[model samples]
Target: MVQNPETIQECIEKARQRLYQIANQYPDLWHPEVIRQSMVLDELINEYNQATRLKKTIKI
Candidate 1:
């Protein structure tokens, strides 16, 4: 139901912030919690990219 790039951007920002928090909380870069949050941030970014790309293609 969410086709808005603005909404996706907000989600990406939130995920990025959360990843930073988790990374700071865990000193080890390889910690499970840190890795999980990093993956989540990556997914949100990828989703945002895909959403934007789709919109561009549709406009063309």
Candidate 2:
């Protein structure tokens, strides 16, 4: 597994760049790999959003 990114946006951008590279280098294997990366990115974004929202609520 890859290490967790410091920020959600950065993680998603890096994953997308990797997905693009994989799609270009290995077209046949791109399908499964892209799906996996996309899922992970989605989860990271969701978790980040939730954490930020919780922090805001606590501050108020």
TM-score of each model, paired residue for residue: 0.89, 0.62
Lowest summed-lDDT stretch of 10 residues in model 2? 1-10
Cα lDDT tens digits for candidate 2, 1-60: 333334666876887787777777667754887678668777877766776777678789
CA lDDT of each prediction against the hidden true structure: 0.86, 0.70
> Residue 36 CA error for candidate 2 (Å)?
0.4
Pairs clashing within candidate 1: none
Q: Candidate 1 lDDT, tens digit per residue, 1-60?
A: 435788989988898898889889998999999999889888888888888898899899
Cα lDDT for residue 42, model 2? 79
Question: Per-residue lDDT for 37 in model 1?
Answer: 88
Clashes of each: 0, 0
Best by lDDT: 1
